[model samples]
Target: MRAWLFSGLLVLLVGCATPAPDSLYQQLGGQTGITRIVEDMLLRAAADARIKQHFVEVDIVRVRDKLVEQLCELSGGPCIYSGDSMEESHTGLHISRSDFNALVELLQAAMDQQGVSVRAQNQLLAHLAPMRGEIIER
Candidate 1:
């Protein structure tokens, strides 16, 4: 009887054990992966006529770094975003809704190129979607 009870308890404990879920950071391949995504997005943006002008005089390297930081933090990674608020940074740029949408498309393409899963890409985009109001038409 004692042995049977011990076996049953062990089985119950094992059944209750579950692996932790992956954080968004892990789904995004962590820091190195996010860096690659940001770099790819920036390169594409620079060539896109509809939005390239916005980046003409900007510091590309700094923009890449800040984007990486922001993405990392938003995705539950270890980096913190040290850049200005979206509104503050875009205030003078007079961005339009189409411009914002184009940039989002660029980012989605970048993520696709990086082989990110569709669910992960959508999750990241959903997190960023709220910022559109802060970025367009200052």
Candidate 2:
């Protein structure tokens, strides 16, 4: 009886063990990983005909900087985003569902290229999903 109790207690303790710390930033390889993902995504977006027109008159460099900053902050990194709010920035753009989907595809491809795990990719996407209302006008 004592042996069975000891085994049960051991199993319980093991079951209660804490999970490893897994912040989105750390899972994404921190600042360097984020920058690489952002750059790759931007390149893809710029090359895609479906969304390239949106950036025709925009400053690509500033956009990249803001993206990196925003992504970093969103992923629980040590960076702070000082850019405009999502709604304010995307206002008047009249972005449609297709446009948003294209950008998300580009981002997913970029994350895959950077070897970001699918779990982390999904985690990031989940966090960004709520911003759709702020970004999409149609």
Candidate 3:
């Protein structure tokens, strides 16, 4: 009986292992939802005087489109990114780690405002976290 019970428990555990969504964007309600979050995040980031200097030289509206496109593609959405490479686009402007972190914070806040669950937000962030290596100044 004990052996049978153990076998049953193992079977149950194995069957419960459903995979997470391959694309976080889909899990977060897709393009419309993602677009809303990105818009909110950019607005908040722009309002931040400490970090707005990064955008002083950029066309914020154009950058906004690129950012939305990039994030959508990275999250496994159907959109393709047509922007310059991170290294190329960010070159010559000595961007600091603090700047990146501030942007991340604003993104998280925007997600919160949009009613995304913490787990979904973290999962999306995890997908983006690796870009820090490429985005930060050496």
Candidate 4:
């Protein structure tokens, strides 16, 4: 009877224990990984004719820093996004759907280059999808 009771207690304890799963931020490899992804995307964008013009006049370093912060926060990391609102920053940029799509593709390429899992990439894209309306003025 004591053996059975002990087994039951052990089972109960095990069942009630909660294991902490890794957050998306951790899956994205924390701040350093996010920084790498952002930098890679920016570099690709700079050379890609489809979106390069949009970045011609902007401060690339500031954009990179803000993108890193934004992605970090979006993925549940410790960083906070201190950049301007999507609409506020994108206003008057005349960004079209094609331009936005090109940027997204560049970002995806960057993530792929970093070996980020597709699941994590989709999750991050899902989080950012809502902001498309705010970013595309045309």
Give each model a TM-score. Answer: 0.83, 0.82, 0.77, 0.84
lDDT of each: 0.89, 0.88, 0.81, 0.90
User: What tens-digit string does per-residue lDDT give for candidate 1 at 20-117?
Assistant: 24878778878888999999999999999999999999999999999999998898777879999999889989899999999999999999998999
lDDT of 2 by residue, 1-138 (tens): 999999999988765442224888878878888989999999998899999889888889999999988888888776789999989999999899999999999999999999999999999999899999999996
Highest lDDT, which number? 4
Judged by whole-model lDDT over C-alpha atoms, candidate 2 comes out at 0.88
**Per-residue lDDT over 1-138 for candidate 4, one digit per residue giving the tens place of the 0 to 100 score:** 999999999988865442224777877778888999999999999999999999999999999999999998888877789999999989999999999999999999999999999999999999999999999996
Question: Of models 2 and 3, which has the larger TM-score?
Answer: 2
- Model 3, span 1-138: residue lDDT tens: 999999999988765443235457766667787888888988897799768888777888788888888877777776789999888888777778999899999999999998988888998898888778777888
List candidate 4 segments past 4 Å from native: 1-21
lDDT of 4 at 10: 96
RMSD of each: 7.2, 8.4, 8.8, 7.3
lDDT of 1 at 103: 93
Q: How much is the lDDT of residue 112 in candidate 2?
A: 95
Worst 10 residues of 3 by lDDT: 14-23
Q: Cα miss at 55, model 4 (Å)?
A: 0.6
